[model samples]
Target: MDYSKLLSKTVVDLKPSGIRKFFDMLSGLDDVVALTVGQPDFATPWHVRETGIISLERGYTYYTSNAGTVPLRRELSAYMKRRFGLSYDPMTEITVTVGGSEAIDLAIRAIIEPGDEVIIPEPSFVCYEPITRLCGGVPVPVATLPENDFKLTAAQLSAAITPRTKLLVLPYPNNPTGAIMTAEELLPLCDVLKNTGVAVLSDEIYSELTYGVRHTSIAALPGMAERCIVVNGFSKAYAMTGWRLGFVCAPPEITKQMLKIHQYAIMCAPTTSQLAAVEALKNGDGDIEMMRAEYDRRRKYIVEELDRIGLPCFEPKGAFYVFPYVGAFGMSSETFCERLLNEGRVAIVPGTAFGKGGEGYARISYAYSVKHITEAIERIEKFLKTL
Candidate 1:
């Protein structure tokens, strides 16, 4: 009868996701060309799916070890070393979780105490700030500028840190803006972080989706590995969103603590997914390249089309979304997207859904087909004419 009084105030007060808000608006609409979701349009590779099916056929429906199967962790260890040049003791440092979302939650919960301030670069993936609040940590959002390609700056990080600083969430090959931090760009932020007692949660879920440049993990940088918790998963890279699997690699001391949370909360990632992920790490390199090449093609087409339509877009070198400035039309980001959806039947997310720093822009995911994107952009062009 009084559910509001019974609910956790934090959960009650948390705003629903801005992305979902717009997506829900499309439920009853017909003939809408939507570019709102961040997931790849590609299905999971056939081999990867067959691996899971094979495991099920063998009746391997039992639970796994709290950290996941040893074979999976070992393969994950080798994959990390091979792809990113980062080394972690598979037995001690890596714990498989339900997804990258859970790994991020475990990392934040493990490190944050009440009043501990976590510095987040805004216009990022939507989870970090609200998750920090749930952990009783204060979220300090530093706006990354469009002029700087939305990359978090060393100066910004240095200024944001205080004696109470506990963590910095580094989400790159970032969501919403598609901004990425190169090794050289990350070096300055790393410099500022040295000896600060602040840990880094590097969310590299889109690591394999960059165009024209290889993904660099901040964990691979000198002295950074010990202080970083690297969270990655198969969802974006392998089109394995439904698998609900991911892993976190951190120093043993830190992971030991995070494992306690995972053990109590999740038990383990899905057994079928773990076995399939091993196959993905071992033989799915070709699948990654094939899908990434297609994403790169769509990325280019959407960016060019948006610019051609007079909505100046920042060329995204990483991730599969393009954020174009929509301020010239003199509407708030939400209003711009809402009007487009209602009047033009083109669906895109408003940047303000990500954070206040995203006020003047809107995010359009290029994760759909070239044909789907073409239709959406053509509709956008017509919408702009009316504006």
Candidate 2:
């Protein structure tokens, strides 16, 4: 059985994420301290958990509507309004997804045509490029730089677009780099987009995790609401990653089409998780505040520690990862990450895994407790001296 010949050429050609290799190597290595994965180190809030428990106890275990439970959608609509001043009609403009991961996949698959180009800003999320390729669209990576604070400049966007370009993957409050696009920074790109037919898929899963400033959505920009599909979830904001729930809000026509795909591919997001998300949407502001505060403290400490150790990193304004320049260490990112894990017994992801622009750096997640982060830094300092 030559199973290799049965796979799609697109799937076969795609390179696996380098981050996974480190995870496989680190598995069961008792001596290593891992700071690789980006997940909140907090439990799901008690009230949200209680809602799920109550739902199951009350025999509410049946599958929800294909789009999701109506009440959950309504609560999400209100939540979006209160937080971002964006209004999405629950009945027509929204579809519940398995996770932000699936929401991204659905949006790309729903709109992108064969050979169409999807612009992805690098040092952003890992999923955007590969998923775009998988959907028979060209993955056009726009490399971001540390000199630009990892933000995608309008000039970069202008250079990346072509007549075949059909979509732009907007991943702000970015992973790996922790870079966020400010309102002012986004205006020039928005101006360029105004005259183009290219659609925007704004991933705002990290919207509630920004430090110091309120996160801004492209959907809220004038004229963009209708052209954008906003992907958000309970994962980062509410520490509900395990709940496996997310939603997509887009134009009614697009939502209708995406719902068809969602209905066939995923009958519905988990019922208990949807019930828990309702509680999160309605009453989780305090939980968000407390978690954000804790994350900010860790964010500051990691940046300061990295600077003190001569790693020269950009102070991240949003998200919980610190991307530190490792060019001074005189090694490729893959070699650096492997040696760091094997020798220093501390796990961090090589930045190159994010994209080409991510070379010469590494991503350290602040999603752990302050105590673990402190120990990681101390170990890092010891490791640096040995180099």
Candidate 3:
């Protein structure tokens, strides 16, 4: 029982995910509507699923190349260039991992040394901070304000940088907040980064889900591409989360180191999933549009309804989540979500799960059907009345 001495302090010291704290309590509860998970409500496109089935039928079940299947990587390279104005050499610059989560880990591990600083924008995804810490990198969380639509401004980026800074995580079309950064917005940040050696890890997993405009990648900026690692996956856009497919596109120099860790840790991403992803990259543009249209409808409806209900939610132009300020109810985000689940039977994540900047806010995902979203809104309205 003296395992404490043998265990890595880093692992022990790492906190559990804040998003799961309340979700774990919903076990065995009936009639509870959970908007906690960020997975797409739609099924994986039939063509993409069919490819995986066909691959299995054809006995294409062996491990892929550590960098992933060449055809898949080629398709991913082309997809990235065409969709996001970012280019990469498929053979040498891209590595398919288990999911976007692995891509995050791989990129951080490759670039960071002990005591190296990585700037993270909060009220964003949950993994960047913990993953950076796991790699012995110090995480400098920059608060993304509601007024700026939760984007990491050039001023914030400039403030967080020092000589020891090694990386900045650019999480846009952001999770929890759903804020997007247009190219105009990114140009100033690019100016700040031009002469600096600070590398950027741009997580564009939700790139395809933008409502009013296309997702912008900092890598597309001139000179910025040399300093950016782009992480994307089939999970959010292609609705293939369970298949667990993702990739990282960076300079060959960085990819070389990342592939080393990935080689020893994970020989390759799943064979079936890689095959399926190829189909998604090649022919799934239409599927993305169809799903984005539905999400846009739901996004608009939920934002309007929440504001109408006096929650004063900021309109989100990207991703499927709507974050409404809940401090007016005189409760912390945790207390608000706890009470809503107990009384209204609706499960939304407390914004604090994302980071400190997320306090007094709650993340409500609109990935559900309109009917389901409407019902949740009604329940939320009733809960607010009781306040």
Query: Which candidate has the highest lDDT of all?
Result: 1
Query: In model 3, where do residues sit more than 4 Å from their true spots?
Result: none
Regions of candidate 1 where Cα sits further than 4 Å from its true position: none
Q: Which stretches of model 2 miss by more than 4 angstroms? A: none
Evaluate residue 373 in candidate 1 and report its C-alpha lDDT on the 0 to 100 scale. 89
Per-residue alpha-carbon lDDT of candidate 2 for residues 10-123, written as tens digits (9 for 90 to 100): 889998877887799999687788999888899999999999999999999999999999999999999989999999999999999999999998999998878999999998
Clashing pairs in 3: none
Q: Pairs clashing in candidate 2?
A: none
lDDT of 3 at 200: 96
Model 2 residue 75 distance off true place after TM-score fit, in angstroms: 0.8
TM-score of every model? 0.99, 0.98, 0.98
Q: Each candidate's lDDT (Cα)?
A: 0.93, 0.91, 0.91
